[model samples]
Target: MADTTGTVEASQPGRYSVPGPPPRPRSQLVGTGFAIAAGAMAVAGALGHYMARRHASGIDPGHDWLAGQSVPNPQLVYALITLLVSVVTAHWAVWASGRGERGHTWVGMALTLVMGLAFFNMVMFSLNRMEFEIGSGEWATLAFAVTGLSLAILIVGMFYLGLMTLRSLGGSVGRDRSTPLGAAVFFWDFAVLAWAATWYVVYVVK
Candidate 1:
């Protein structure tokens, strides 16, 4: 034993260390929202294609043609305005959220204020023009049914989010940072779901 080498190995157990910065950049509203919206739209689009083909024989040309009547409808003006404002707000929110500036609070507040008005206007216009009665027992009925239900959901959800966003901005003055980005993501997801459902009905049932 004395002749053997006296060197001994350090026998310490490996220890786990606390995580530091994230492996990747933190995700913002736009990043995740885009993915979600895109996915929903894709699903809707595929379903819509299938429905359109299947219901082609059943779809009444007279009924389907009515959609053309509203082509370039005056409602487009309001819809465009809403789209533009939302786009701007979305861009700003994404930028601000990415930058982590507390000032995005003000941007979110402004967006919520203006978007609420646009949302109300659109809802009024849609409600005024949209009317449907029960159709013959067929794909027509199914399409109409789905579209109507989807529209109802969209109308309620959109307005609700608008109110929530506005409240987050305007409920008393303080430096409390609001999760406007999260609201925006939620709103977009709602919209995508509505569009998918509505257009799917139209495409397949038509």
Candidate 2:
């Protein structure tokens, strides 16, 4: 009975120690990588088909592949530039998140969102300027298909970005919890690259 409580506490220190939360899963990043690879292959295949069709049409000295439908080159260039800037801001968000710079992270996310919207608006404006009629010819249909696919990808990327931003604001993203933001950034970068490829094939090439 002599100091029994003191003896028991001394013999079981681990019994009173609290355990920390489990490590977050890495599946999100891995799944995103697979998605990006699949998307890249799909886009490459579509672009290759477009090139084949163009080549089949025969590019003689005076033959125009577009059949006189003028592409808005200036607007397309500005859209690409906007996307490139968004890529920087997206990466900045991830970088700041990893360093625990919450303020910088928020700014980066906000800027990236704005840039993404700007790119979308520019693309829409360019499409309007082109006055494309899907029923006009095979070229028109192919052009619309390619651009539509790229825009769809961009929309998905922007949606993911918004979700990640919400999570970050809720304090779910931080130094040790930046994987979600990183995944979003990766997807956004892919979206930008997809659009660039679309621009080169659909605008710059012909």
Candidate 3:
């Protein structure tokens, strides 16, 4: 009496639906959101630090203490680098998520958490020492702290994504894992280098 013909055909094996790849995972949204938030914070911190330094030195907007040197405006440069790293890490998270993987590797996550905390401590200690010596006001000190914290978050996210990419390279995790892994390695290592340079130049030398 009813439309039983359609129901009968739907019951047939491989008749109602065509075989296809599984739906892609959505866990990457978490990492991407984190990366973007960290980037926003990083930009704010960078501006704060730059302004504080400029104010301390009584330098006009167009001038810098290292005007004679080729690599002037260290704070702004560091901010730009952090922003770039954030973007790359976010992209990696999206790519990995699209592969239908459930989530990130635990080892990578642990490593990133540890390194990020350590890096944050180093940055804060160095900046605080400078603040103490220079007797900077509360606002300037706050700015430095903000910059350090933001960069720390960025580093953790980036490191996690980088290590994940590296892990994928060991096996056939993805078709082009190597490419992303290379980028991860570069950015992760660059962060370390940048930290060391910043410590020496900003805290020790300057």
Top-TM-score structure, candidate number: 2
**Model 2 steric clash total:** 0
Ranking by TM-score: 2, 1, 3
lDDT of 1 by residue, 1-206 (tens): 46877787765565455557654333544554664566567546655654665456446653554433332234634654564566566546545554555367457546744674575576456545644334633444554555455555455445644554455445422322334445454655465356545553454234
Global lDDT of model 3:
0.47
lDDT tens string, model 2, 34-90?
A: 989988998999999998888888655114677765666998899999999999999
Please list the C-alpha lDDT of all candidates, in the order they appear. 0.51, 0.88, 0.47
**Residue 48 of model 1, lDDT score:** 65
lDDT of 3 at 203: 33
Give Cα distance to truth, residue 115, candidate 2, Å.
Answer: 0.7
Worst 10 residues of 2 by lDDT: 2-11
Q: Considering every candidate listed, which one attains the maximal lDDT? A: 2
TM-score (C-alpha) between model 3 and the true structure:
0.37
